[model samples]
Target: MSVEVNNETDYEVDLHDVQKLADSITEAMFIHPETEVSIVFIDEDAMSELHVEWMDLEGPTDVMSFPMDELRPGSETAPSESGILGDIVICPTIAEAQAKAGGHAVHDEILLLTTHGMLHLMGFDHEEPEEKAEMFTLQRRLLEGYTGRPAPKETVE
Candidate 1:
């Protein structure tokens, strides 16, 4: 799996860890022998600008995902053997603040973002309550499964 992560932030969000987490997520899918996702980490300012430009929002967001396929939400869209899945952009500064506010570690928050973005890439959405539940369930499973082996204590702690 090629997790081509482009870090555009000053805050040190471990690119290696992010890549491993992404690879584990792909592994959990099991269907795709190879998968690729581009992860970009940016600062609050850049995120805010992107939010406004792309999403027409005024403030920074923790993360934003741009799925390559146009598959309707709630439908599965597997990557071709080429392995290009989609793209995920993250903001670590906002993530840390959100993590503190949400009472979770920064890593946990980032993992959640990655999972959420991946679900979107796989054609999932939270436009409705049921859909949201389904997506969240999948996200939790991926996160737990990935962190379970790599950093057991930290995963829980």
Candidate 2:
């Protein structure tokens, strides 16, 4: 898998750890080894602009995903086809605030957002009750599997 990380914000984040997490997620999801994904960390202002432009939302959000070649998770016996997975844009400023409110480390929240974005890239969504449950459950499982720690509980929106 080709997981590229670009930090365009002034906030300090461990790019290598983000890359590792992305790699781990792709591997666990049985995505093709040649699949490509980009994770970009941007400032709050840029995030807000994207939020309004892409989602029609008002403020900066934790993360947003722009899938290139739509792909889905595959079984180990039949991995997903090689393609461009998507782009994940994260706002560390917003993530830090959410982390403080949730009583978790900022890095952990960032990782959780990364997992959420990755799931979205793989055609997962949380619009309905059942969809939300399934997506959040999978998100928590993936994070716990990668970190070997209990994932923070996600609240219903």
Best by TM-score: 2
**Which residue runs does candidate 2 get wrong by more than 4 Å?**
155-157
List per-prediction Cα lDDT, in the order shown: 0.73, 0.92
Q: Positional deviation of 2 in candidate 1, in angstroms?
A: 1.2
Worst 10 residues of 1 by lDDT: 148-157
lDDT string for model 2 (69-142, tens) is 99899889999999999999999998888888899898998999999999999999999989998999999999
Clashing pairs in 2: none
lDDT of 2: 0.92
Candidate 1: residue 72 lDDT (0-100): 32
What is the Cα root-mean-square deviation between model 2 and the actual structure? 1.1
Worst 10 residues of 2 by lDDT: 148-157
Q: TM-score of each candidate?
A: 0.83, 0.97
Per-residue C-alpha lDDT of model 1 across residues 1-157, encoded as one tens digit per residue: 6789888877877788788888877666642545567999988888899889998999989888887743232213653344467888888888788778777788878877877777788777888889877877777778788877332111111
